[model samples]
Target: MEPVKFNYEYSRKIRVGFIGCGAHAFRNVYPTFDYAPVDLVAVCDLNQERADIYKKRFGAEKAYTDYKEMLKREDLDAVFVVLNFDRNGHPLYPKIVPDILKAGIPAWIEKPVAYTAKEAEDLVELEEKTGQFVLVSNKRYFYPSFEKAKLILESDPFGKPVSVSGRYPLTLSPFQEELGKRTNLHWFLDICHPMSGIHYLMGEVKEMCFIEHQPSGNVQTLLSFKSGAVGNLELPSTQADTSPFERYEIIGNKQNVLIDNGMRLSYYKGSKGSGEYGKAPSYIGDDPTDGPVHWEPEFSLGQIYNKNLFLQGMVQSVNHFSNAVLNGRKIERATLKDSLHLTKIFEAYKNNRSGKWITIE
Candidate 1:
């Protein structure tokens, strides 16, 4: 594990201005600054009361109702945007981030970077013109479980990753035309959590086909990756509320890795089962090296790894942006390009029908 540096221990810090003081930011985004190298200079929201409260609660220097005013007054190294969606279920980032980029400030915007691929493409154009970058908060790229899985997949023991599967909870409208309406896109946009993870591990998807089971509206989407690996993503809407929310598996030549409930990880190495299939005396194998390796955090300890903020990748994601701003480190993940791929997948769903393959450009 890499050593973690607290905010005060860093030699340099990025002076950051925060936009939006909503419930999500209040709960997840702002608190990550405690573990990251950030100097909170200002916060902005349409509601002055919430902005002021967040400023005081998060130890920022100032608060403003207008982000443009905050941008004019503060010499910020970067900005964090975590706004809620509009009434139409469209994310507010695409409309808000161009101004921050125009101010020559790099931004870390929460996901659903846009409602459509065209909107994401517009942001890409602005990024090139202004020479300012935006890192979309696709936390799965930073999640430790996926990170370790990535390393294992690249190791010689795992061979080639041939296929992948994931299960997540999502509800879709029964009407085919409803898929394209911005009003119905909230759940689809939010489902990017698993989509981002699959894209990160499998690379770009070339084509996809989804079948929906209604009136429950459960869905299963089949994916064909550009790397030639195939994938299946299950969005079963009938799971119990108390059930484990997500699971993912990546299969190699003979071995496979599994992530259960987004926390526990098990890697099966295709070891021989005891002696013979039915003649084995014990199910446990004799060779220690061939056994499956497993890992999960111990809840008994008061460790950073045990915390949801770290486990879910919020701390590392924030740290990456801060380091990129302060140390001039290049962002290799969660780029606008990644957002483009995600949005393209969104478009695939929006424009295509069930059981028909849609090609992603």
Candidate 2:
């Protein structure tokens, strides 16, 4: 059967059902429905009280304590699963995604899609068999600054990406043998952050080598992309609580771009001022406009740009998914293939030893 095509001008809103009513969904996901072309029909959660409260608050027509019952009764166009982790710190996406696909509806799942590579492969196979879409919500790829980076990298002005550097506050796990009983949950959860950025900027990784520091649990991974680009990822676990969480740099032949905290961006096309080492009166450039162009949202105004959903890329990603489902266009970012690549990175840390290079297929 052919996919449904929505009328861009006046088609009714696509009916969406949500599976998890957690704090994340309440703050980020449900709020986005107001801006997107979505009609939230139903919501499901393990806790009946929370489900009922979300249904009333978010305008969901029905709420159910059991997700299976909600899927059975509602003819939903799509489902969003923002569930928590299992006992092993594994995300519950692998267990729930298949059920959503079997119901003949597309789904958008929150990331760290799975704990292992095999689980991700299983989801990929299910997608192929059902011909249904499943998008992992990797919000960093959808951020405005990152989107601008994508354009710069793809455009002729930047030539080609030669190297990348990313900084994120993350904790590294112990060696695989010792990870069996470790209480460190950050390794499993935080791998997705840098992985999403790497996948978005550098494409799939061809090979990677990593080194971990024991005292601070800090890690640094060196990556080689399929495009022959090189990357360094640093996860510093001791960052200040009030400081921004991430920073990324993409270096090309004559151009370089930097994105700070997912919102601020700067592009350096070429060297601006040239002077002798000691003869230069000051390090300052010729004028205010001669060097790289910078972009950042103004925080003074009460606007969507200042909000976490918009600044962090959640809103755009959710909107894109809804539009694709409504308009019959294929999803461009956060595709199932992208999720598989991310899961591979997650598994690399889980199963492979530190300082070893793992190749992703």
- Using TM-score as the measure, the top candidate is 1
Assess every candidate by TM-score.
0.96, 0.91
Off by over 4 Å in 2: 1-11, 176-187, 274-290
What shift in Å separates residue 246 of candidate 1 from its native position after superposition?
0.8
RMSD in Å for all candidates: 1.7, 3.7
Candidate 2 yields a Cα-based lDDT of 0.83
lDDT of 2 by residue, 1-361 (tens): 0122322433567898999989988888888776677888999998999999999998999999888888999889899989888877778999999999988888988887887778888988998898888889888888888888888899987888999999998886676565543345545576787789878988999988888888787888999999999999988888898998889999997789999987889998655356787777655566746568899999899876687877778778887888888887668888888888887876676666687788987
What tens-digit string does per-residue lDDT give for candidate 1 at 1-361? 3346887897778999999999999888998988888999999999999888998999999999999999999999999999988888888898899999999999999998998888899999999898888999998988899889989999998887889999999886655564443236587776778999998888999999999887787999999999999999999989999999999999997889998998889999845556766797766667767888999999998888898889999888888877888877657789999999999987776666688898898
